[model samples]
Target: MLTISAWKRFLIWVVIATGLIFALPNGFYTRVERHNDALAEIEQLGATPARQEAVAAWPNWMPATLVNLGLDLRGGAHLLAEVNVTEVYADRLDGMWPEVRDALRDARDQVGTIRRIESDPDVLALRISQPENMARALEIVRALAQPVVTLTGAGARDIVVAGENDVITVRLTEQEQAATDDRTMKQSVEIIRRRVDEVGTREPTIQRQGADRILIQVPGIGSAGELKELIGTTAQLTFHPVVGRTADAAQRPGARQVIYPSIDEPGVFYIMEQTPVVTGEELVDAQPSFDQNGRPAVSFRFNPSGARKFGDYTAENIGSPFAIVLDEEVISAPVIQSHIPGGSGIITGQFGVEESTNLAVLLRAGALPAGMTFLEERTIGPELGQDSINAGRIASIVAFSGVLVFMALSYGLFGIFANIALILNVGLLFGLLSMIGATLTLPGIAGIVLTIGMAVDANVLVFERIREELKTARGPARAIELGYEKALSAIVDANITTFIISVILFTLGSGPVRGFSITLGLGIMTSVFTAIFVTRLFVVMWFERRRPKTIEV
Candidate 1:
């Protein structure tokens, strides 16, 4: 408010300073361990121009190495898997021997106790009779750890173990393969995260949603379909039938492999391989290369134990057909012509660079426990993402300039104050995004554009009010005071409602939508501060110099 010009000046300067720090981007002002790692990797590869530029820029000018982009702007993929919570419950119950023992004891006594025990979304112990078996039931309940199966007994008496039972209760009661508690679901999310990392989409965002669902965002993904194919398949490796291949076939199917249904890609080739004369699961690492036949192949070497296993398998399976299937496709079905017992082997197939790299990553990680399916599919091509980013940047500059010219032209000399505030408002928005590490998507850029207009509008509101007060012949300071007091409520009310909507969007939306909401919301706050405090500070300095009774609006 004009009531405290000195305080306003201090606050505006502070906001501007803080925003500058944030706007610089992490590592821009300082180099760290991350810069070294990237440089090392680039140098080791004998950096191409692009890679060299990335290293030269280091923490500044370069995009953040770990900077996570929203799925839309960066062009990535999302995959959701249905976790097998049934196995988890079974395993947990197996481990909960003491509690199970106590519950069974109560039931055996024919007293009021846990009658039936079934575990589905959440672990449960059903109450049987009453008073008689109550002692054993109490004992069973006592034996459970606090984080153990959320006790939902079918009796009149109950207790809340935690503040929110919603996270641990039998909310969706019927799915055996599903998990309902925070612990199990969180565990599943962690596992999925590990699995996605192995898939080798760098800096992917994997998090849990609700109790059972997982949210995964993989940025800079080239093939959304392929990622869906790779991640959606649980890659649950097992020995199975590929009856199509005969050891003495007239011609081999490129390499000896069988096709099964892919869990990730429906109707796609799944590897029907149980008979691994050698398994990559045993391989410590794999590198891609072209074989002697000029065909793309992956070269892998096994550990000592794996070497022994491979040597034995090949020796035993001599003259038998061994297949190598991946994600259900029979890439090769090479026959064991003889006992070629080496710890190292090559997988030659229809391999492009990405396909080989992805397969190598997956094989290096070991198999998953179950199949997975995609709940949603989204694709953002590289060309399109770049175009959008360019458009957004151009639009922001244009919109901002337009706001500046309009404010200055309409308000005359005072509009200069509005322009200065508007520019600071932008810097503050960038600073906030950098500090908070919020992703910036194309939609978020639009939010920034909108914020520029709003910042100018807030200044206009204040200036108009000041001009009106000046009409009553108030002194310069008094006119400014009246202006701020009147405009404060309208500015706060309008921005607060918008902020609430932004909060809702952030809370309910996923991936890019959340990014947009965060940027938009930050923009609103920054705009309000810049316009109210910053512009008012400029007005104070102006009034002190000119002592004008009326200001142009």
Candidate 2:
């Protein structure tokens, strides 16, 4: 008999119900989106009357997951930025200065006096008073060279040291530069992702394009310029010892001192020591809070090592002004009133609540490894996205309606069963997408249209086989059973090959290609299930009830 067991029949309906339930939220996308947003805000900021009303827009018992709309379908900001990895070379050489100076100082009896010379940003040049001792200085600097950590750079020293006529120059080796560039790009991508996530945007695409370029696509952002402002701030915070205050911007701060303008005060600058006591890299946490004066401020805590250094510096430098520098500008230069032992500090400045909150976010996300130059930027409008959505909906409807009509006409009653299965197949596809939190793009819609066409292939094969079996004078039940058994191998073989291709596409492709692959891959699984199991179940149930003596294809 072509009857499904009780457990199998029950399982099939349960699956179909679950899929439809999960997919239900998409039908009321706006209401459910508002509900989800309200819920998240309630969890983060506590509920208000407006938020509570929004939350009540959708029922709490239903599945709240909705497929994330891609950049093309939702409108967003797009940017292609080239990271200045070479900037790190200058910072690396500057950090190496103290070590180099200390090493050369050990041989001062032979080397005489050494002074750092103004040179190219990537090169650290030093002039020694004694010309003949240059060999000794070179040896000391070369001894400080560490082996590069990368696979291709193994056994190679990170720095190249050379001397000529009393001047010694140091620079990063080519292999080390390559390794540093790679690290810089990876760090840039991660930091950009964190900054964008801080804004609570959905499914952002922050990916590396080439060697030093990054592509960022953020859905629902106002503009590319706004996005650039959010991620471009380096937020390089450092606690430097203030040398003196200055009014003249052109004032020359002697060697090893930098002059930075005060952020809040006009026409005032602070001369700061080049070496910082602590940097934002040591910061463990930062949050927006009110200072003692009840003004908006950012509160920060340092890690243990930073805490120790900060505590010692404050303890010794009481009554002296300490420069709180961000991106080379002194934001605050407050006198150390007393020893602060706990490593916690508040940054008070001319800021509103929003500015303080954004500052806290930037500090928490950490500084970008280097600066980036925007190579390309674009802002897509929601009106354009809505147009794309309307076009895709029309295309999908046309395809779906055409498929339903064609299937019904060709296979008669069996074709109606196939059409019902095809409908369920689309529902199941959306259910899977919602469950996985997949982003749906325009190409993904095309995949759905393709799936609707392919969904009836198995049913067509089975019905044609049954037509052949009926001609052999086989009983209706036996013919239906043999038809499914014969069609099973062909269905699995065809879908399996296509599924493998989708997997490969997903593995290698990015952006829209990835979106298409995800939908196609999921569509294949649902289509096969509906075509074989779902349509067969409908046929068996109808036949069992009607007890048809003869059936027409």
Candidate 3:
């Protein structure tokens, strides 16, 4: 009865061996992590001698991954930002002005001449020459409205058109606002993630907090200010046709054009068309490079649609100056020297090497849908993180040693087998963590130490069951089999209940709490496996080899 088939024995040993193999790299975590990073860099930049040597520092055949340390463990910057979703509403309304003008122009005889009027920042207002024809104008503009595609939007339109007196007002409807908010938040999170990843930090957490706020935690970043500076620039790059150059800052160039001062020259200003031919959203790639004058600059390539539009505009507007605007400021106004057919161009400005590189990174990450205001920011130092790690390490070692000694003293040789299984259980836990690239925090360490005590509970239950069965009229093999059989129900019930709790914590909790839940949940699984399968296989092998007639409890 206390026997295992050949296949079962192989499976049991294979699991142990696999766990050991994966767990081995964690013992040399720093070396393995550096090796992995070096290999990645080499692959990206083409294999170089130095990088090849760095990769050789750790063998290629070995497991290269290590459990990522969390912000609490590694020390980093934390920021809570609120996105200005309302600003996007204003921009969306402003963008529709051109289309509204063209649509109303078609029925000029009925709607009369339309002139833009200053109104609320979030509303588009237009004054019609003929007061009685305001309804006709509103009807033409409302035809441009599209249904909001969000679940909450239902049948509502994206824009609401209303006419009062001679003024036609356009504003984003409630449904559209809800949809915009969702898109803005998702875009903000994604852009923030891209910006952070560009700096090559490991495992940064960028998540949405409420409806309009974002929580960013980037490990290994020195300060919150640094993190803010990296992602703060809206980086809204656009190419607009230059209407004319102006020296006066106060000069208003109608509603269709804007006046912006030159970055290189303080006194000079450029009046550029508000509507851009192509925006950075269409850019496929951007990189830092040097211009003809050896000045730091950024070169960008547009996507196919953008390229065709850009090429057509440049070919038609040869010899006309075009403004390269960055965040509403004019970077440069370069005249088209020839019929530029390619979608690629260079942005030349007063930039240092670092500034040019930063610009390239921001452009590549894409623009945030809306601006963000930092509500809270803080930085955790590496010293504090190191102290936490040291404390956790000491605690784990103490708990593990005490448990090992107690189990050995309590059950003699049988207890030693449990101890062996316990060590393997921990090894298996780390193996899974590393393989999955889970982040481990201080709370996670507590979870591991807690697991050590619980790991032995299963063995204790079976050992007690065997002692009870020995008192009955039964041989060693029959008693052992019955012991395992009786303990199985209690083991399953206890572990399953605990595993369910871990799942709940993981689902509901954030950050550190989730980390704790992960280790605790993983511990529950590994402990059960080593306890029932690994420990029993050891006992079965020993019993079969010795042909024991009797055994002491």
TM-score of model number 2: 0.96
lDDT of 1 at 122: 35
Which of the two candidates, 1 or 3, achieves a greater lDDT against the reference? 3
**Reference-based lDDT, each prediction:** 0.62, 0.93, 0.90
Best by lDDT: 2
Best by TM-score, which number? 2
| Runs in model 3 lying further than 4 Å from the true structure | 46-50, 247-256, 292-296, 338-342
Which residue pairs show backbone clashes in model 3?
none
Could you estimate the TM-score for every candidate? 0.58, 0.96, 0.95
Candidate 1 ranges beyond 4 A from true positions:
1-11, 24-54, 58-68, 80-148, 151-185, 195-215, 225-369, 375-378
- Between candidates 1 and 2, name the one with more favorable lDDT: 2
For model 2, state the Cα shift of residue 254 in Å: 2.2
- What is candidate 3's lDDT per residue for 1-553, written digit by digit as tens? 7788999999998988888889899898777887888878977668878777778889888887788888888999999999999998887887788889999889999988988988888999998889898777877899999999898888899998999999999989988999998998999899999999998898898888889999999988999999999988899988999999889988989776788889988899999887788888899899999998898999999999999989999999999999999888899899988877779999889889989999999999998778889999999999988999999999999999999999888887778889999999999999999889899999999999999989999999998899899899799999999999999999999999999999999999888889999999999999999989999988888888898888875
User: Alpha carbon lDDT of residue 186, candidate 1?
Assistant: 68
lDDT of 1 by residue, 48-121 (tens): 67556655655455344333455666677766655554545543443344454564564565543333333352
> Which sequence of candidate numbers ranks them by TM-score, best first?
2, 3, 1
What lDDT is reached at residue 384 by model 2? 90
lDDT per residue for candidate 2 within 352-439, as digits (tens), equals 9999999999999999989999999999999999998999999999999999999999999999999999999999999999999999
